[model samples]
Target: MKKSLIAVNSVAGAALLTLVAGAAILLVLMFSTDGDADADRRAFFGSLMFSTKEQADGSTAITAGVDDPVPLIVLFVVLAIALTFIQLTYRALKVHRQRLLEERGLA
Candidate 1:
């Protein structure tokens, strides 16, 4: 049972790490701007479904529908905290079980 619990925890941790890493990579990509003139400026906006184009002046003429990042950040933080709590709880449970076995002269 303990071995199975450890295996499950390992898999969960790996999956969480993969998700966090992917999100981090995506966030980095979102913030990164390449210094290429030929780079399609419309691509980014198009990905976000933005249809308005910039005028001769230096101001945005169109508003695009987009999801706010604040809520996503908050959700990620909450998930990270929850995963940490689960890991700590698993460790504590394993330790407690070991101590119990020792106390009963089973180990």
Candidate 2:
């Protein structure tokens, strides 16, 4: 059971890392003005949550169709904090367990 839990956590961590990396890539690409209109459109509007476009009068327009990204951002921040806490707790527990085993000559 413990091994399965660890495996699941590893997969989840990998998935989270992949998602963060993808988001970072998209953000970088979104700002890259490569002189390609279609590519720029795709990159800028990649996310379904919200989109921002430049207007003709040098102003930006934000179009969020009922899906606000603030809550999603907050959720991601909280999840990151919780994941850090969980990892720290797991490491501490592992060290304590090893210490206990060594003290009892079981390791």
Candidate 3:
């Protein structure tokens, strides 16, 4: 039973890691730009809510219009912590069960 629980926990942790990594990759891809002229200008103004000058390289480098990734970062951190806690709890439970079995001379 203890060995089974450890195996289950390991599988669950792997699944959780895969999910987190997929989400992170999706987020990164969504925020990536295509360098389209009109689209970039629209994104810049929409994000900044103001007009801005073009850069020396003929590109509009809007300082005020960066996408905030704080929420995503926080979500990932929470998920990782939760996964760690779950794995730890699973291992602890497995150990407790083994100890109980040993005490009863059942294993």
| All-Cα superposition RMSD per candidate | 9.7, 9.0, 9.3
For each candidate, what TM-score against the reference?
0.42, 0.42, 0.42
Candidate 3's error at 88, in angstroms?
A: 0.4
Q: Which lDDT value does model 2 have at 78? A: 60
Residue 56 CA error for candidate 1 (Å)? 23
Question: Which order, best to worst by lDDT?
Answer: 2, 3, 1
Please rank every candidate by TM-score, starting with the best: 3, 1, 2
CA-lDDT, candidates in order: 0.53, 0.56, 0.54
| Model 3 weakest lDDT span, ten residues long | 41-50
Candidate 1 segments exceeding 4 Å error: 1-66
What is the TM-score (0 to 1) of candidate 1?
0.42
- In model 1, the clashing pairs are none
Clashes of 3: 0
Compared with the true structure, what per-residue lDDT tens digits does model 1 show for residues 2-47? 6566556655665676456545544544445343221222222233
Candidate 3 local Cα displacement, residue 80, angstroms: 0.7
- Model with the higher TM-score, candidate 2 or 3: 3
